[model samples]
Target chain A: EAGVVQSPRYKIIEKKQPVAFWCNPISGHNTLYWYRQNLGQGPELLIRYENEEAVDDSQLPKDRFSAERLKGVDSTLKIQPAELGDSAVYLCASSSWDGYSGANVLTFGAGSRLTVL
Target chain B: AQTVTQSQPEMSVQEAETVTLSCTYDTSESDYYLFWYKQPPSRQMILVIRQEAYKQQNATENRFSVNFQKAAKSFSLKISDSQLGDAAMYFCALGEYGNKLVFGAGTILRVKS
Candidate 1:
């Protein structure tokens, strides 16, 4: 079984430029998530998708950050006009199901390291 | 709102020895899941162990185990006979019905020879 896959393992961009990260979750997984992790800090959820529908995006920065999970198999997180503070690791994870049971285990990708100059 | 806290920013232990990393959380909900993830230099989040809120026996996986104190809202990871390969950043995370995770600041473990 293949694990979660992410592209552009590392990215570098200027402060005012636009950057996007992509994620392809494990096969048959129904839930997908996007998280941001700063140096020395754990990951914080930015958005969640349940089969192509964004069910939670309260933590996403509406002004500069946007995400989409079209078809629910893959996801993209975009940050336009990036800021220096946006330099961090963007991680994507997926789970098989929700609620009780199903092991509820999350398989995470290697993450895309975004460095905003 | 739910929050997870990792009191120790860093910890070190001699090879073959034991070390424990502390974690605490605040939540009003009764049903949830707690997880310990180890991220090495490779940056992959590896699931070391997990515990369900309703379980009392605790969760153990080989050299890794969790001490889950439900009343105190504390979940600590104990690594027995630590190895150099265990050097990594360990994160404590919480999740409910929707698969949304709330993570703590994380603890860095250094294994000494």
Candidate 2:
């Protein structure tokens, strides 16, 4: 089975430039999440989507960062006028609850590494 | 608020030896989930193991196992017969039922041959 897929495994951009990351979640998964991981740190949740609706996005920086999951399958996270502190790995994960077991396991993608100069 | 802590920033284990990575979390919710994720040079987040809060028995997967202490709010991972492939950044994460995950800074595991 195919896992969650992300494009542009590595990206380097100058400060104040616009950048975007794409993610294609696993088929049949209803929950998609975007996380940012700094060097030597664990991932921090930026946003979470349930189908076409974003259920949790309180951590997202509305001033510059924006995300959308239009079709409920693929998602895109954008950072306008990116700053030097925006350098980190953007990870995408998907999960679904098993009706019987009630277990929700997250499957992660390779992640997009963004280096802002 | 929920927070996970990994006191050891780095640890090493000789090949074929056993090593334990310690983790502690603070959460008000009694029923939640704990996870151990491994990230190698490839930078992929791989799920190593998971422990349900209500489960009394510890979780074990192959050479990897978890010692879950509910009252102590501690979850530790034990890797037996460590191999070079096991060297990576190990992260401890906590999540409540139908909630977002809270992660620690992570611990670097180094396996010496």
Candidate 3:
């Protein structure tokens, strides 16, 4: 079984530039998530998708951050006109949502590191 | 809503020794789960162990075990016979069914050989 996969393991961009990160979750998983991790910090959920529909995204910065998970198989997170504060690692995770009995255990991808200069 | 806290910014333990990392969380929901995840320099979050809130017995996996205090909302991880590979940033998380998992700021663990 393949783990969650993310692209552009590293990214460098200037402030005000647009940056996007991609994620492909494990097969058969119904729930996908996008998280951001600042330096020396844990990952924070920016958005979560249950089969293509975003169920939770209150934490996302709607002003410049947008995310989409088309067809529920893969996801993409974008930060438009990025700021220095947006310099962080974008992580993607997935889990099998088995109704109420679900463990909600998440499997994560090797995040895309974004460096805004 | 849930919030997880890892007060320890960093911890150090010698290889082959034991170490405990402390975590506390706040949640109004009765049915939820707690987790400990390890992130090395590789940047991928790996599940270390997890505990169901309703379960009285703590969760254990290999050399890792959790001391779950429901009343105190404390979940501490004990790593026995630590190895160099154990060096990583450890995060504590709380999750309810069909809800997003809330994470702590994380504690950096250094294993000295």
Best candidate (score: lDDT): 2
Angstrom error of the Cα, residue A32, model 2: value is 0.4
Candidate 3 error regions (>4 Å) = A98-101
Q: Which ten residues in a row have the lowest lDDT in candidate 2 chain A?
A: A97-106
Interface RMSD, candidates in the order listed: 1.5, 1.2, 1.3
Using DockQ as the yardstick, the better of models 1 and 2 is 2
In candidate 3, list every pair of residues with a backbone clash.
none
- Report every candidate's CA lDDT: 0.91, 0.94, 0.92
Name the candidate, 1 or 2, with the larger lDDT value: 2
lDDT of 3 by residue, A2-104 (tens): 9999998999999999998999999999999998988988888899899999998989999999999888798889999899999988999999864655578
Candidate with maximal TM-score: 2
The 10-residue segment with the lowest total lDDT in model 2 chain B: B94-103
- DockQ for candidate 1, please give it: 0.73
Instruction: Give me the displacement of residue B9 in model 2, in angstroms.
Output: 0.3
True contacts kept of each: 0.71, 0.68, 0.89
Sorted by DockQ, highest first, which candidate order results? 3, 2, 1
Better of 2 and 3 by DockQ: 3
> Which one wins on DockQ?
3
Error of 1 at A37 (Å): 0.5
Ranking by lDDT: 2, 3, 1
* Model 2 docking tier (incorrect/acceptable/medium/high): medium
